[model samples]
Target: MNREPKAKSQEPQTSGRSDTGRSERAKRAEGLPFASERLTFLEHLTVERGLSRHTVEAYGRDLEYFAEHCHERGLALPPQIDEDCVVAFGPYLASKRGLQPVSIARALAAARTFLKFLAGEGVLPADPSALVSRPKLWRRLPDVLSQEDAATLCEAPEAEAQAGGRLSWRDRAILELFYASGLRVSELCDLKLADLDFQMGIVRVTGKGSKTRVVPVGRDALETLRRYVALLRPKFAGPKDEDRLFLSRTGRPLDRIAVWALVKRHGRVAGIPGDYSPHTLRHSFATHLLEGGANLRAVQEMLGHANISTTELYTHVDAKRLLAVHAQFHPRG
Candidate 1:
């Protein structure tokens, strides 16, 4: 990854520090119960996932609220969390905090995602989030490209690559890898040249919370990547480029924004509808894999999802398949 430029030294803060938005949150959450764990998760969101400042602060505040609730109840959390800890959260939100239904639901959702991450890290024995009843809102499935649409998008850059277009090789490789590996945009951008193992047909990805996973690269994407490395990458390599597998025209490592723009431009060229982004390719990758009868656990690991519950999201939306199974297996049927 391209190193962020160091900030110039600034004046030291006064004895009486002015605690603003994030500072105030930290000051409050700092002394609260479970502050250590909460701070670690917030750091994970900021550093690993590269979430925006406001977004990380939002999560920090929401988690602070949860911590306060637990503290008030004298609930023993961490090293173990059970249904009781999760079960009481909704009532505490509604009655004690007097949060509206929507606000309460949002908190629960955030907490659920957070807890799942902890569980995946083995910090918690199990995720207790599922014990609480979720607000029965419509589940929005991810925007997924059909296989034909995905093929069109992945193939869209070939003409440009063939015509000696600038960075077309890089673009082709990125698109193919996006479809093949089901990587989060952040994970994809974090990849290094050392991560790829063509002999093994795998790439090592460092994902959220600094967790690493190995995902198989399809033959097409792997071959394209080899060509990009041999033919194009050297041309773009700068002294500071280091081991980054992907580089910008300036020889700096590619960031998430570049990947998004690349996917959007290619989506338009492919004439696919609904403003697909890099995430669309990721969603499609998981969707296609599961639809191809890929095991749930395998997909969970490949996508670098902290929790299998997330991987299960792609499966749950297949209503027709669920119904077919019911009809086939039920004794009454």
Candidate 2:
């Protein structure tokens, strides 16, 4: 595996802070609940993934939120997470913090993705988020759901997982991975079997301009992917679909349009209001991470953006939430 290259300096300069001061902060971060892991995850994105500065900062905020949430609920480490913790966090974000459904969903998604990361890195025995479904947000609008409606949508996939069919398994795998890794429709359609690295829980993607990057796939998605590859893909595949990750009933590779249609179909079936496209999933993937405090550069890298400015477009999507924060905290407001 290719690792991040370290930089060499011609000259070294010392800051006013002493080594003891640096050690103290490191110790303090380690002592805090989930702080060390959070820092390591962010560093992985930075040094290992080559994510942009803005993306790293966003992830830092999201990790801090997770740490704070875990600290509040007395969840000191990954092992402490269970289905209840996952479920309860949603309500706490809603009722306690008065966050909108979109924000709440974003937070849960981030936590789910983060736990998957920990599990991949062997920090946890298994992915606790596997059984816990991601909270879905309405397209274009942050349409709020009744408590019951939210629960139903969340568990709908779990129910489907229990009553599995070849198509069901394949669809679930595709959808889970779409949100998990935030792949472009084209990138997703072009995926080959050889690209998946289950041990690392990542997929090597060739994005726009033929630039390739390896992105971490969340644990829950990886689980579904295993099932899809082992059982489902072979069922639908002909010689044409042999190497492709996704395929149609005719055993041909699926096109981008097919993926888009699948997302829309699933979104509607889940009772999610408004229309959805494959990019809708992509938008949600980036938006949720940012909303959860992912670094802007990390998101950009994951999305295979050539320029940081393109990724900044997602920040604009948070205008309302930004205004809400300003209203609550701004002295003049």
Candidate 3:
């Protein structure tokens, strides 16, 4: 552990990432404590697993942190990882990284996956993370918007859409698409010309793990998207824009951060309270549907949740609503 930081400290830094067979990122992974195994795992993640770049990057960081921790104990990951090492990782994350319980649990999950991968590869005899208890986190409900607030936010850009400006209906369309279909930010950005069916009022979204699902879009949202495509997207489409449904001023497809900034900007424009983000609209979309008597299975399908349990969080509603229902229906009261 003590010798590794020095070995890496003297190594020259490499800039720029390549997506070739052996990328710079993969090569850097090879420089980690478990050089070969880690590099192979990372390459597997990109080539075979087909994880998104962001997700793969996160997994790589997790492995790097674990390797750094191991570096503190030994020059590199030992022939075998014991349970004690996995247990120590939790405290290390808490004491050194100041990670919250949820974050720590997530990091541990990444480690567990890596360990399992190594075990399968015969590099490790068994998974050390198997016996470790992940931090038990409280079920924190997501923040949701009221119907009126969501509508207000969606229309906030209308006032500024005058005379076919630079933004035009693009921002409004972004918000509407989020609220209407409960699409994740990445799914929204990944949308393409072939994904939309205007006649059916649905959008085919490629979600996490490259899973695709058709989510119905409201008529209003479809209309806004149509207007944005017809008015702005034509000019925004560059030779390289491909068939992406959303684009920046430079005709490049919008990235996650750009769309998030757009959402927050319009949130302030709507004068809504508390911080607003793209996911807030998604949460609102699920909650409003459940409150409107939408079936749980249906909502789960719409949200593209692999598990119904994840979708059930919207069933919590809000404390105020629960109390009101209790007051109205409880006979003992």
TM-score of each: 0.62, 0.51, 0.86
Candidate 2 Cα misplacement greater than 4 A, ranges: 1-165, 239-241, 325-333
Q: List residue ranges in candidate 3 displaced over 4 A.
A: 1-31, 78-80, 318-320, 324-333
lDDT of 2 by residue, 1-333 (tens): 221111012112222344566576556556668877887787877787776454565566555566666778888877897777777778777776788887677667777777888999999988887897677655444222333443333334554455432366777787778777888787898899899999989999987546799999988889989988987688777765478888766577776556666665556668877655666667777877888799999999999887998788888776766898899999986
Which residue runs of candidate 1 sit more than 4 Å off their true CA positions? 1-136, 320-333
Worst 10 residues of 2 by lDDT: 2-11
Global lDDT of model 2: 0.71
Considering every candidate listed, which one attains the maximal lDDT? 3
Write down the lDDT that model 3 would get. 0.81
Best by TM-score: 3
For each candidate in the order shown, give its overall lDDT on alpha carbons. 0.79, 0.71, 0.81
lDDT of 3 at 142: 92
Error of 2 at 297 (Å): 1.6
